[model samples]
Target: MIHAGVYYTPGSLKARFCLAGNQATKTFCDQNNICYDTCGKMLVATSELEMTRMRALWERTAANGLEREWLSAAELREREPNIIGLGGIFVPSSGIVRYRDIATAMANRFQAKGGEIIYHADVSALTEHAAGVIIRTSRGQEIETATLIGCAGLMADRLVKMLGVDPGFIICPFRGEYFRLAPEHNRIVNHLIYPIPDPAMPFLGVHLTRMIDGSVTVGPNAVLALKREGYRKRDISFADTLEILRSPGIRRVLQNHLLSGLNEMKNSLCKSGYLRRVQKYCPSLTANDLQPWPAGVRAQAVSPDGKLIDDFLFVATPRSIHTCNAPSPAATSAIPIGAHIVSKVQALRESQINPGRTLRAARSVDVLHAAFTR
Candidate 1:
């Protein structure tokens, strides 16, 4: 199954840690000959509340055998001359990778193993039986196989619904707009400069990131997206918009985050408002330094009761598994996650084992096969 990399990965959904995530990505890159940078990452804190949270993060990571440092305001200024904040948690190993390059390598490896890949194959239907599963694609193709799995990214929730499982969540698209710092302003930040995120919210807030090419990027304020595949602010699909509007659960969430939603929309529309978000930590940026970059859509899983699904959630059947909620850190933890899923499939094949019992007891994973299949 193809995994959705970084962007689809959520905001502290799986873990409120970046070092572990980055380290995991770095490890994958090293083992696969994928090129990546180790520019490190910094999460700056301004208020006493942020400072206290930073300290807690430092201690928690340290206890987990992770390397982290608590830096002073002056120290932060020395390393990042433009950074303005009280202090921050510095994770030296946190860096960025060329996502495309990593994805290409993985695809090549998959094909090299004699695995057939059908690009642009839109799965339209699924039928499961005691013998096997039949998958129908929009391109007028069909395949029968012993087992089936789905990793349809933004369309995962819909695809899972076709398989007869509710999965207890819906995919709500969130648009995150970004800006590349002008060439001259690239030196303004030495590492990834992130403002401490609100513990109550999933978003990490706006921060400056140094891509693998050494260019600084800022502002990825999250806003509701009208289309799942929409890449531009104006791009919209009437069907997608209608589907989202009809969901009462989604409406409840919008009401819950009313002010926050409006603020994000403001930042998305106003360049200065977006810049001010990053300016909280990086004071050197001017509106002129904001260069245009393509925006990304996040497939955020929202529960039926108006809560964000904040972990790796997988719903399964006798012969198939569907990823319901897998946000950030997924790219970094791909290898381990794949291994974990493989174990679940293996557990199901035991003749004497109760499939439901096997799935539930399989490493604490949330298996919905028994709930749905029964």
Candidate 2:
């Protein structure tokens, strides 16, 4: 991401946007001079059985100050001329931004503030002691820090293991493949189009998104990957593959979602099967209109009990704090997450910095941890 610059156009918007952290994300956009669409609309296309649940979501959030409305079938078509669906929840505050640009901007600012940016410095080991935290990089370089935080995405679990902290969660990579709409079809969706996510499934079925480039991209059906860093359909790692198959975590996930797993695999193999998901709501799209787009791999954290970790989980030591699981919305909450970590670091008494706080087990859903006061 630090190397790729051109790919960061028209920021990344996904299935849905939340009223939470919307402001912080926008703040990032403004600071970077990144152009973004604020009045972002994301449509949650629903199945017949999902209407009740969708209605509750709208009811719960509508009163929170943002414009939330239950659009009727007629209303959906009337408002979005290209959409064809029964109806869904409409969130007007949802939006999209160039995430890479935001990251680059943050890096530039960090450097300006006396922060060093080191490229290709993959950490091979981390050790905490009275002297501080010692980091050994893969390039055979050693660096020590007064404090260290781990935000490694796909490799977070492995890195935490090096520091010898385990929260009973393992990261399982699920590759999401997306297809671009031909320029002719780009005008089809004016807002973000999302399928009502199944409560039982870890991944939302395929959805449509309006990128900042005035292009529409569809798909991102979740499929198990053979490697954690593998972004392509065929990219595989023998070691990572073996590790995943042998893990109790992956086994439990497979046992619980056998049919769902197979269906996702099918969607990945057959283009028609994948297209049918998009067709469910956007009937106007045809196979010919689909083009190639880069796919994303999500580092989904799963516990030994077959449940996906839906919330961000953190583990802390005296000299270190590790973000074991942070994916989607993590990008949205980058500012606050950084601030929260800094606050915690600042509050640490020099004497207590070694043992720090015991990492209690808690489900971190939407909110950041309370202010870490001295």
Candidate 3:
């Protein structure tokens, strides 16, 4: 995932963790001889209002310790003559790498460091014991651990509920529908190209991404998925649909964001509307150049008050720490985020060992638990 820089608030967990994650990823890639490019990214503004907003974006990047350079219309044209812009922000620190490969490398490193990962072992249930965490898998095998840390992406909220914690949100899957440009048009964009997002929304707006493989991918229109794991249209599971509709949090979120959500839903169905989003910046892209590509589902945590959780949220009970909401830029920030989680769990473990001396620390754990219920 591209670290778009502005989705996270300054000094927030998402911001710090993502900045750290970006640095860690680069170090890992360099050490492992992985191919990556620090080609940077440009957020182009075509209108007068958007140009004014570009200053705020620049300030945000600087506050986050990211290196960014602003470009005038003439300068932007010099950088990419084919692209048109009234103003823009050029982020030098932004870049690209293959996430699947990074996951593989991380898995290997985790195993080498004595971290065990059992594949295909879907967790069926979780029971907290006095001594440790007892995890029951679908295969009927029970495993015990001194402490449990859950990074279960899509199933996070359900896992929290299974542990008897009342998470105030529900996991709603939003599928990102993407299309790849044909080989002939691959040279159209030499770097990442983006449009200034709506100031009121959480989404970064549709943008162009240059993959490490030298292919260009456009779009990723957000649409509510019929299934949590749905990769294509019409892929639905009754249980998944029921789980969403049954949740009061999700219902309220939908009720509140109905207008914006309906627009996304419309784009999902109307190819013409979807294409218009692309045509806004890249006038040269025609519907014929858009081709099917593998899609990814984003597990968004929706609150009962109709708000989407945009930052990283964590909940800790005596037995486990649940990551309820980790959206886009998560993959970019996973390394530091993982380290942060490990630190929290370690701190909790230390408190458990010396409850008398670490009374305050113990209380902090309880606070986390209470937060989960609230």
Question: Which candidate's lDDT is highest?
Answer: 3
lDDT of each: 0.72, 0.71, 0.78
* lDDT tens readout by residue for model 3, 220-299: 88888888888888899999999888888788777766887899889888877888887766778888888878988888
In candidate 3, what residue range of length 10 has the lowest lDDT sum?
Answer: 365-374
lDDT of 1 by residue, 71-130 (tens): 899988888788888997777666677888877877888899997889898888999775
Rank the candidate models, highest lDDT first: 3, 1, 2
Candidate 2 lDDT by residue in tens digits, 20-121: 356767766776688878545545554777776566556545444456667888898887787777787677667777787787887888899999988988
Residue 79 in candidate 2, Cα distance off native in Å: 1.0
* Poorly placed runs, candidate 3 (over 4 Å): 2-4, 357-374
Off by over 4 Å in 2: 1-20, 62-66, 349-374
Which residue pairs does candidate 2 place in steric collision? 10-212, 11-97, 11-98
Q: Rank the models by TM-score, top first.
A: 3, 2, 1
Candidate achieving the largest TM-score: 3
Which scores greater on lDDT, model 1 or model 3?
Answer: 3
CA error at residue 21 for candidate 1, angstroms: 6.0
- Total clashing pairs in model 3: 0
Looking at model 1, which ten-residue stretch has the lowest summed lDDT?
A: 1-10
